[model samples]
Structures are given as C-alpha cells and as structure tokens.
Target chain A: MITKLAYKNILGNGWRSLINIFILSLVLTGMIWMQGLYDGWSRIARRQMQEWEFAGGHYAHQDYDKYDSFSLDKSFAAVPPKLQDLIDTGDAVPILYSAGIIYPHGRLTPVVIKGIPAEQNILRIPTTHLRIQDPDTQILPVLIGRQMAKSINVVKGDILTMRWKEVNGAYNAYDIQIVQIMDTPVPSTDMGQIWIDYDKLNEVKALKNSCSVIVLKNQAASTYVGSPWNFVSIDQSMKGVDAMIQTKRVGGYVFFVLLLFLAMIAVFDAQMLAVFKRRKEIGTLIALGMTKRQIIGLFTMEGTMYMLLGSVLTATLGLPLFFYFGFQGFPIPQQMSDFNIAGASEPIRCYYSPIMILSTFMIVMAVTVFASWLPSSKIARMKATYALLGKV
Target chain B: MRKLLILTLLISVSVGMVFAITAEDILMNIDKNMTAKTTWSSSRMIISTRRATRTLSSVNYSKGNDISYSEYTAPAKEKGTKMLKMKDNLWLYDPSTDRVIQISGNMLKQSVMGSDLSYEDFMDDLELLESYTAILDNDITYDNRKCYKLILTAKTSGLSYFKRILYVDKERMIPLYQELYAKSGIKLKTMKLSDVRKVGNRWYPMHIVFKDELKAGSGTTIINDDIEFNISIPDYYFSKAILKK
Candidate 1:
C-alpha cells in the first residue's frame, strides 16, 4: 500500500521529480563510466605487459635485482642444462644483461644492454633485426626502443658507440648501428635499454653459456629451472601495473564522492521541502490512524522510487554512450608514454561489467534512501493539531 | 793512422748511442720517474662541468699502486670523506653518514666524486712495463722538448686501458702526454702531465689533467701542491679503520 502511495506521489511531483531522476541517472552514468575506464586500463596494461615483456614467467638469476643496475654485471649464471634443453626446443629464451653506456650524438648516456636470441619467439621484441652480418665486425646491429631512440635523438641506421666492461673488467667499445626501433608499450623492455644478438654479446663479454634471465614460453616451462634461478610468476610480474591502476582508482574516489553528493543533495532538499509544505497532509494521515513510522516509510519509498526510475532511465540514456566507448575506445594521448606506463600509448576500451553496474546502483540507492528518511523522521515529533493547521 | 782512428772513434760512439736506448729501457726510465716506493702528498682536484666548476683539496698517502688512502680536507661539503684502496677493493667513507661502503666490480669503474677519474684509475697499481709491451714509434717535439713517441699494448686482458700512446720527455723520462684507448681502438681518455719537478734524482709532473673523451666537460685537473718521495708513511694511514678516524 505504501509503495503504491509513494509511486503516485512521485508522479504528482511532476517536473521536480523528473529533475531529481535526471540528476540521479547522470551520477550513475558518470560512476559507471569512470569504473569502466579503470577496468579497461588495468586489463590493457596487464595484457600488453605480458605480450611485450613477461610472456608467462621469468627465471631470473638469484642475484639479479630489477632495482639495482649495479647487479647487472654479477647477476649472470650458467644456464642450467635442463633449461638449456627448453631453449633449444624453442620453449624458452636466454637473455644476458650488462650495464653499459652509449654515445648518442656524441653525448654519453647510460643504458642497460639486453642480449636476446635472434630466433626466439617467446617475447614480442623484434630480435630478428639483430641478426644482420657486419663485415669485419666493425659496427654491430642493435635494436633500441622508440622512447630510447627519441631521448637519445637517433633513428634507424644511426650509429652509436656502445661501451661496456668485460667479465674480467676490460672495457670494450664499438660502433653499433640501430637496425630497428621497437615501439613497445612496456617501459621495462624499452627505455634506456638496448637489444642485441645473444651470441654476439656473450662472446664479447666472454661469458660462455651464461645468461641473466631465461624467459619461459609458459608456466609449465618453469619446471625445468632449478637453484640459483628464481621463477617470477606472471602475477608477480604484474605488480607494478596493478599498483599503478590501484593508485589511479584511489585518486578517482574524490570525484566519485562529489558526483554522489550532487545527487544526494538534490534528493535531500526536495524531501525536506516536501516535509515542510505538506504538514497538513501528514496530519490527516496521522488522524486517519496511519502511524508516523508508516508516513516516514512512504516518503523514504518515494525517494528510493526516484532511484529505481533513475536506474531505468540510466539504462536507456547510458546504453548508447557505453556502446560507443566500448566499440570506439577512448584515445590515450601520446604524451602519456613518457610516464612509462604500460598500454598508455594505446586506446582503452571501456568494460562495463554486470557486477560493476549492480554495485554502483545499489550504493546510490542506499544514499538516496538515507537522505529521504533523515528529513521524513521529523513527522514523528509533530503534534496532529499543529500539523493540521499547517504550522511547523 | 790518426785519421782512421778518429773515424773509428766517431762510428763507435754513434753505434753505442744507438744501442743505448731501447723501448724497454725508455719504459723503465719513465716508470722510475712516475712511480714511487712510498709517498705522501697534498693535492687539489678541480672538476669542471658545463654549468660550473668545483675544487676539492685532499691529503694522500700511498704505498705502491695497490694501497692508498685519501681524505678530503677542504670544501665543507666534502670534508672528512675518505677513500681507501686495497688491491681491487675500494671503500669510501662518507662523514655525513659515518658509513663505509666497499665499491667492487663495475662500481669501481664509476667516476670518483663526479670527477673525470674513476676509482679503477686510482686502483691500478701495476708498473707499466709489467702490464704492457712498448714499441717506440718515433721522436717528436712536444711542449718544446724532444720526446719519444711510444705505443704500448696491453700484455693481458684485464688492464684498464688496452693501448696507450705516450709522449715521453727524452731528458726527464716522464710521459708528457698520453692517449688512453679501449680495445676497440677508440680513444677513451687523454692525460697531460706538466710542471716537471726533480726530487732525489727523479722527475715527476706536479700538474696532471685527465679528460674523459665521452663526457662533455672541461675535464679534471689535479695539482700536487706538496709532495715527498721515498718517505716513511704511517702504517695506520692505509688501514680500513683509519677511514673513520
């Protein structure tokens, strides 16, 4: 009975009720869109990281620390015989790392030298470009990421002087031609890094059959690796990307609260004014044997009904916007690449999951009902005579 | 008979002079003037960057090339910072933190106090003749003095510089100018030695400048304000414990 009464009241309120419904729907739409953006960014970042750098897992030398550049020289270990079989069978690839400096445009810049096999398909890096033959071995073919190439101001065919210390501490330097500039979304595989043929680098460093990391084709390939090599799982590798998305999500909370606040204030103001102007109606309901609790419930139900109608309107109004963004994707700016974020260079397609929609709806409805009930509770304190005369 | 004797004497003297100086002999003489058995010195290092220049003063004590200690004495920001080199191990004590850190492996190759010189350069204690094979290229006039141009190739793989082109002052047996090259034949650094001074029958350059070819800067100059050769240095000066003291 109260539900029917509340529905009639919402309709009787006319344009005022329509305005409240419109505001609620807009807030819901904004919340859903923001959620979709975060979800889309997180999804793309993880996928791109897996594609460009971490394939399935990494078997890194125990001494190798991603944070410590100084560990590059001492972190290499002899490839375990079992893991070597995987490499030979194309299920894995060995990578050697060295700390080096490159003179690009005659300016010295520090770089991390990564040596990957030319024939390996474990990662998306264009290592095949590193296979060119150099007559007399004067200038070796090397690969640089686009960001690295840009920062150093070089392009394909530009020769840079690369210098590094050998395993025995002898410094070796040579001219390196940039055969390819890889456009990788993952910063770890790119910025301040150089890629060369694995055999050539190993030979130059005089570290035979040794590597700093063995990238596996899948998690199953890790079974072949053993001591002095620690397996870094895919989840473990995505920690950086996850942390970045989480931080962004936390930062979005303030915006979300403001949107919710706008809708709540509108509903709260309407409910307070309705209580003030309809005191005679409230007194008649009390005189007719309707309880104060019942009257408050009716008003609260009306505010919740606005949310329910707003949800239906949101579905109607938000469907086209969601579909457009879902298919077309939101274009990311080019300058975002400087932040070293994975997938920041690519468009993020919004993902509107059912759970995300339902939760947002429930949260907005609860706040709306609370705002309605707070003002409606004043009916319990009103005297039937005073309300009957339309006095406060 | 007198004419024949005079001609024989002239030819014999010329032959003796030609045989007197070989590449190895010149290297030995240069090494004797460059290195010392024990030495103590007060020096100032001036490092120049594109933006500005900084000068630091220090007192140095050394026994051979393998063991040495330095403590910065001037520039309040750098004062009390000490470095001790024992063989391949290099430790730095920063008074700010009162901590000593051992720099090893590739860390030794990094510049010292942002200077053009690296710890590896200071840790190199081997005599030139022990680590390199010298071939005399030719004679050249350098710094208005007759100098022997010699090319030295590393006899082993682990030496800092693979090849060094040195211009040795013929009279003083000190290298006036040097070009340090990597194995790839690219010149990595150049050094100039000037202000030659004699102490106890040995010639030593008091002013040395080192320039890293790959870096953009005016380079670093080291001036030895006071020096002593073959003098007894306190044994405690080279100890690790002395870094904190």
Candidate 2:
C-alpha cells in the first residue's frame, strides 16, 4: 500500500522526479566511463610489456646485474645444453649485451649493444633489419630505437663507428650501418640501445657460444632451478606496471566519491522539501490511519526508485557511447609517445564488465536511499495535530 | 803457479763489478732523459678510427710535470679549443659554447676528440719511480736498437696501470716501447717511440704512437714537429684567460 502511494506521488510530481533521476543517471554514467578507461589503460600496458619486453619470463646469468654496467663485461656464459635445445627449436631466444661507445658525426656517445637472433619470434624487436647480405663490405648492420637515433642525429644508411671491449678485455672497433630505426613503447629497449645480429655481435665481442639472458616462450615448460641462473617471473618483472595501475585506481575512487556526493545532495534536498511542503499531505495520512514509520518508509522507497530509474536511463544513454568508443578507440596523443608510461603508446579503448556496472549501480542506490531516509525520519517526531494545520 | 792464479781471480772480479747494473739506476737514467724544467712544443695529433682519420694541430707550453696548457690551432670545427692541466685537474674551453668544462669523475674516462686517448691520460702527473718498483728483465734488440727490458710493478693500489714493461735504448736512455697492463694482468695499451733525433745534448723521439688495446682501429700518433726544452714560458700562458684568446 505504501509502494502504491509512493508510485502515485512520483508520477504526480513528474518534472521534479525527472530532475532527481537525471542527476543520479549523470553521476552513474561518469563513474562507469572513468572506470572503463582506467581498466583499458592498464590492460594495454600489461599486454605490451608481455609482448615486447618480457616474453613469458627470462633466465639470466647468475652474475648478471642490470644496474651495474660493469657487470656486463663478465655476466655472460655459454647457454646450457637443455636451454640450447629450446633455442634451437624456436621456443626461446638468447640475448647478449655489452657496453659500447659509438662515434656518430665525430661525437662519442655511450650505448648498450644487444644481440638477438634475426629469425626468433620470442621478442617484438625488429631483427630483420640486422640481416644484410653484403659480402664485399665488412660493415655490420645495426638497429637503433627512434629516440636513440634522434639523440645521436643519425638516419638510416648512415655509417657510424662503434667501439667495445672484447671478452679478453681488448678493445675493438668497426663500422656499423644503421639499417632501421625501431619504434617501441618501452624506453629501456630504445633509449641508448643498439641491436645487432646475435652471431655478429658475438664475433665482434670475441665471445663464442655465449649469452647473457635466455628468454623463453613458455615460462613453465622447463625448470632452470639448481643452475647458476636466475629465473625471473612475469609478475615479478612487471611489478612496476601493476603498482602504477593500483595507484591510478586509488585516485579514481576519489572521483567516484565526489560524483556520489553530488547525486546524494540532490536526493537529500528533494526529501527535505517533501517533509516541509507536503506537511499537509503527511498530516492527512496520519489522521486517516497511516503510521509515521510507514510515511518515512514511503519516502525512502521513493528515493531508491529514482536510482533504479536512473540506472535504466544511464544504460539507455551510456551503452551507445561505450559501444562507439569500444569500436574506435580514442587516439593516444602524440606527446604521450615520449612518456615512459608502459603500454600507453597505443590508443585507449573503454572496457566494460557486467560486474563493474552492477556494483556501481548498487552502491549509488544505497547512498541515495540513506540520503532520503535522513530528512524523512524528522517527520516521525512531528506532532500530528500541528502537521494537520500545516504549521510544522 | 799460485801467484798467477791469484792474478786471474782478481781480474775476473774487477770485470764482474764493472758490468753490474741495478733496476733503479736504469729507471733514473730514463727519467732524466724524459723530464725537463719547462718545455714549448708544436705538434700534430692524428687519431684514426674505423670511420675516418682526423688530425689536430696544437701548441703546448709546460712548466715542470704539474702544469701545462694546450691550444688547438687546426681543424676548422675544433679551432680555439684549449685544455689546461694543473696537477690532477683538467679544464677544457670550447669556442662554440664559450664555456669551460671540468673533466672529472667518469668524464675522465671518455675519449678526447673521439680519439683513443682519455682525459685521464692527459693529466697523468705521477712520478714513475715514486709509484712503481722496477726490475731489469733482459737485454734485447727493439726496432733494430739494443735495449734493456725493465719490468715495473705498481707499489700502491691506486695507479691506473698496475704493471708496465718498458724497453729502454741502451745508449740514449730513451724508452723504445712500453706495454701497460691492468691489475688483472690484461694488456691494456702499448706505446712505441720512433724517429729519434738529437735536440741539443739530449736524444728525443719525434714520433710517438699510443695504442689502446681495448679499442679498435690504429689508435693515436703524435708527431713533434718543433720542440724547445728549458724555455722561459710566461705564467699567463697556463692561466684560464689564455684559453679564450
């Protein structure tokens, strides 16, 4: 009977009811949109990290330390026979790295030389550029990232002199031709990096059958335990990305609360007006036979119905916007390419899950009902005789 | 017969005493021929890399072993570049930037003018015998000249090269070849001197080659075109004001 009365009053209010529903719907839509974008951003970053930087995971030499560059000189050893078989079968790729100095246009710049197989599909680096069939000239083909090329002021076809220490600590230098400038989202791979063929780099460094790290296609296929090598897991390697996403999600919650506050304020104001301006209606209900508790219950139910309708309204408007953006992702700004943000080099697409949508709807509805119940509870303390005279 | 045997033993003892030479004496002799109170020199430095070879001409003024100033005079791009070395410190003046940059810490390890020589190589001020203990290895012929091979081991842990093998010319007391070794026993660099000439009473090597074994290519060759020893150089020449001029 209270529900019937509440339904009649909402329909009778018309425009006033629509305004409350509209505010709730707007807040719900904004929350959903922001959540979807953040989810999409993190998803892409993880995907790119897995595809380009860490393929499944890696096994590195026991002595290899990335932070200490001096270790690069002594951090390599011959690949074990078991891992060698995986590399031979195309399930893994061996990377050899060392510190080097390059002279481009008579300026000396320090760089790290990474050697990988031209035929391996383990990492997303463009290794085909390192494959050159020039038998007459002894020029080695090398690939540098776009940032490195820009900083060094070199272009494709430019020949630069590269000097590095051999395994025996002897220094050697040779001319290298820039075959390609690679574009990668990961700055660690591109900045101050030079990629060459695995065999050619080994020959240049005078290190035969040696590799610094072995990247595997399947991280769990083989156990490299008990060996003098470290097995890095994908989760451990991509921990930075995970931490960044979690921090961003925390910031997103602040916005969610602000939107919820705005919507709650509108519902609270409407309920307060119902208690004051509809005192005559409240008095007549009490005089006729309705209890004060029943009247309060009706008002709270009315506020909750606004959220229910708002959710429906949001679905009608927001679904189309989500679908359109999901199909054609928002283009990432050009300036973002220089940012070290992992996986942010690509455009962002909105990701919507049923659980995310339903939870947002439920939280908003509960807050709206509480905002309505607060002012409606004041009616229970008013004198019925004074309310009947519309003086309360 | 007993008197004749005594006379033979005395003659053999006198001959052995005359041939005895200590490692310290050889090192002191080489140092005496190499060091001077003050010197004024004009030379050309040729640095060869895998890409190309570049030549730089400069004039240098030095007082003792601690203070020296060098100004580049050739190569249109590097013209007006000056380097001043006071003891262990090195400062470079660039005409393009109009700035003076101090080469210190890791910057000392970088190549100078894309050459195999580093800034640390230029500011080497340690006296040889003070930091190293020497031993004579053997007498050998190098570059068609009879020489004494002297092995020098660093007395302290702080020297750049832990050990050095030097071949010194017997007559001139000048080093003909030097092999520098790292603490790990790795041969790091080699220096060879040729084209000896008599300047006043002292013999000097006009052509010198410094090869860094850790780098590829032919290394750097410094040819001394004009060398004047024991010259009075003005104190203002080594000052910072002379760099811009």
Q: Compared with the true structure, what per-residue lDDT tens digits does model 1 show for residues B140-237?
A: 99999999999999999888788999999999999999999987798899999999998778999999999988788878999999899889988899
- Top candidate, metric TM-score: 1
lDDT for each residue of candidate 2 in B184-219, tens digit (9 for 90 to 100): 465667999998888877888989999877567888
Model number with the top DockQ? 1
lDDT digits (tens) for residues A1-392 of candidate 2: 88888878778778888999999998899888877877777777777877887788888888888766656767888888888888999988899988877877766677889988888887899898788586445678998888888888999999977776667544556678999988887777888899999988887677787889888898875575446678888887778777987798889889879878988988998888878889999988888888989989999989988888898899899888788767676577878767767766777887878898888888898999999899989898887788999887
Model 1 stretches astray by more than 4 angstroms: A378-392, B1-28, B48-56, B71-86, B89-107, B133-141, B144-151, B235-245
User: Best by lDDT, which number?
Assistant: 1
lDDT for residue B174 in candidate 2, whole number 0-100: 89
Please give the CA lDDT of all the candidate structures: 0.89, 0.83
Clash pairs, model 1 backbone: none
lDDT of 1 by residue, A1-392 (tens): 99999998889888989999999999998899988988988888888887888788889999999988889998998899988889999988999999988877656677899999998898999999989575468788999888888889999999878889888777888889999999898999989999998988888787887899988888876784667999999899889789988898878868889988988999999899889888999999998989989999999999999999998998999989888888888888777757888878788888989999899889999999999999999888888889999986
- Per-chain TM-score of chain A in candidate 1 equals 0.95
Query: Candidate 1, what DockQ?
Result: 0.57
- Individual DockQ of the candidates? 0.57, 0.06
Q: How far is candidate 1 from the true structure (C-alpha RMSD, Å)?
A: 3.4
Clashing pairs in 2: A171-B213, A171-B214, A171-B215, A173-B216
Error of 2 at A96 (Å): 1.6
